[model samples]
Target: SSFPAVLTCKAAVAWGPGQPLVIEEVEVSPPQPMEIRVKVVSTSLCRSDLSAWETQAIFPRIFGHEASGVVESVGPGVTEFSEGDHVLTLFTGECKTCRHCTSGKSNMCQVLGLERKGVMHSDQKTRFSIKGKPIYHYCAVSSFSEYTVVHSGCAVKVSLAVPLEKICLLSCGVAAGLGAAWNVADISEGSTVVIYGLGTVGLSVAQGAKVRGASKIIGVDINPEKSEIAKTFGITHFVNPKECSESIQQVINRITDGGADYAFECIGDTGMITTALQSCCQGWGLTVTLGVPKVNPELTAHYGILLSGRTLRGSLFGGWKPKSDLPSLVDMYTKKEIQIDEYITHNISFEDINQAFTLMKEGKCLRCVIHL
Candidate 1:
């Protein structure tokens, strides 16, 4: 299925940190063996995208890893898929041969990390260009533009019943939040859980808890308005950290009868990380961190929290296997148990990626999806 297509695309490129992202023309190559070229129909500019933008994670970076689209081409040895397949692009790639891959935790696969670090297919170079110069791949996904390339390991086929726009959110943020509860934290039936930072990820945590039969799902955030958003997603209680900061710990303990059984730090803030860990029950609690704090990933809390059997752990990509997890999530959405459709607060075109970032920084938008 070879055809003549120059495959030109306009993508947002951040020359460096604290600088604006400018769209530039880049040529996308056709798929090679074990690779597939996808024509991204819809992509999302998420908070994590802004994190990469702020950190200058890569030079001439093509952001927007959360995306869904049609398969344009499939390279050889790719018996798993064919052209015209509806699929979702996973930023995390798995090499199956790596230790992390064989362990059944594809999210933690080393190859996924390698691909995000600008490592491309067998050629050892990026697929997109920055003014004729090759640009690095951010998290193995660069769906900000009209098209992007990926190895077969990274492309997960999904049902066509799911809308492309909604599936776009699942690329990372949605997957991470929901995955934390279902896979990482595993909130038990009728358990008490608290989630910090009421963003999309936080809301998803609350929703996951609701589906898991959590009796009291408490949400905490500095923005009081987020309480409304949290409640809509099945949060049983909401707390304003700014107003309750002094006694937030006591308030949580009082509400949960001794703190919560599971805690999630959804916002990438250091202070909230500490609060999430300390807000757990005296013992027999789990704290799962979904936030990527800018500096000092190490967290501090009273050792007694852990000494008493409180568990503090971290997970990436929501401990999801793209193939298995993506479909189950779609089923959840179809069952109306998960509400990705109602969760979206804004929708911007690819042209407004910058404004979306600005809105995210202000903590105003729950989700700002980009239509291709």
Candidate 2:
């Protein structure tokens, strides 16, 4: 089925940096070849979305990457999916022909990362516009709007059995966190795990560790209030950096008897990145960084940290190939192996979407599901 050549819909437009998204009536063009048009059913807010909103470099672009929706139309030559099929949007693409995708070593497919120029890869054009001015796509999904056109590779077909509102969390943050523990970190049973930051990602990490049979799960956060929620996800220990007279790393070392077997940094601050590495056990500890840093994306960790065999790794989309691994995550959620429904702290309407951001800024939400 094909949508009209043009359709008008409401979208939250990011006019400039450090500004509230203006909900505007925007025009969405029909999908070009190799693209598909989706009517967003539900989308969730992530810190990366917040980062893009605050950064001046990505202004004037639609900023949403995690969402689930139904297919409204399919462009020519699209065979993997059709109109009315339920789908989840993927910020990370998994074009099977790509070297990375074929090698099975990484999920950083070339096709997904190829659109850094802020336009559709097929025709190098913007599919959205307001008053004839083009709106650049954000992370290839731009799900902040009621409708979005994206590469067919960016849409993952999933079971209709799961509600779009509940499963949308798998579109990004949930998958990234679980994959970090399961795939990237390859967390082992009986391991000592420490996670910095008690947001959705960190809490998901705790769940992953529990699933893998980790004996000790420690959660560190500046906010002591997050301890209770973190505990719901299997966090057995909580460390408030403010309560310790010494450094948090030293505190963690004393608590873990030396250091944690694995440490994850989900706060997205470069300074925390260093501390996350140092909190790991010497000679065999592995640290994974799942946060998206807003500025100065460089780390200044001590050379001794690496010299002692503490490996530092960066996990994007939790190192899972979206098309292959994402569906299984949904299955996990369906089977009750992971928590998704519990993560939703708020259900918001499209007009009140900005309140989700406010809730995020105030550390009052785990994931805000925007009902489109």
Candidate 3:
């Protein structure tokens, strides 16, 4: 029997850092072993994509990770997913055989972990190319193109009943926030929670806290406009650091009467990590950092912060093993146990992808879904 031929499709390619993406016809190769080719129906713009586009030295790359689609073809030795199966692309995969996957204590899969070099984990080669020139992939799920090939472990099969466009948010931002609240922090009922930065991720954290029965969910952002919209996600208060006379931490401490039970730094600024720690109560206070810092990756918190029994930890993809955990999140969305549609502030065409980046850079939109 003959196999499918190489596909030439439209993909937004970034030739260099901070450059606008160029929509061009690129050749997508057939999936190798342990991989699957997907027809991306919907992709969302994420801050990490923007940061990578603006900063990462990897050029001639395709960048879109938070996405939903249908499996177009499966590679050799793959039986978990079939052609036409609806799926969500995962940046971090769960190779169930790894120690972390077996331990049930971590979502970081060693074999299919985060790919920083824009290539497949199994073969170290990209499936996207133009005229024999390769185009690097971002987070291994380059959904900016009409079609993308990803490792089978990096894609999670979802129900066909869910809308591909809306459920795409759960691929990253929404799931990350909810997981931080539920899995990492295990926020308790009636506890005070302070979240720094009210982006989609932060707001999702707020929503998770609310669902966990937290009494006060304070959202801190520079934009005062986010306050009204954030209230719908269960934020009880809003704090604008620029408007406060004292430090933001001081304001939070004063309002909560002794700092909050939990504080999350959602902004990708490492500087805010310390503020988040200080904003938490000394005893049993937990600070979870969810942001991918664009600069100054190193964090500096006073020794006393730890001495007082406060704990600081980091969360990646909300500590979710994509293949094993994302399906439950999809179920939660279907049951209305979570808010996926609320985060979609704009719907855009594939041609208008640059506009989505502008909306994110200007902080004008929570999430911009690109219809491919």
Residue 159, model 1, lDDT: 81
Candidate 2 accuracy as TM-score: 0.98
- Candidate 1 residue-wise lDDT at 224: 81
Clash-forming residue pairs, model 1: none
**lDDT per residue (tens digit) for residues 62-121 in model 1:** 877888999887777888888889888887766667787778755666665435466574
The list of candidate 1 runs beyond 4 A from truth reads: 3-6, 121-123
Compose the digit string of candidate 2's lDDT tens values, residues 160-198.
999899999999888889999999999999999999998
lDDT comparing candidate 1 with the true structure: 0.80
Residue 1's C-alpha lDDT in candidate 1? 54
Residues 1-372 of candidate 3: C-alpha lDDT, one tens digit per residue: 245568999999999998999999999999888899999999999999999999999989999999999999988888999989999999999889999999989999999889999998988899999999999999999999999999999998888899999999999999999999999999999999999999999999999999999989999999988999999999999999999999998999998999999999999999999999999998899999999998889989789999999999998998888889898998988898888999999999999999999999999999999999
Best by the lDDT measure:
3
Cα RMSD, model 1: 2.0
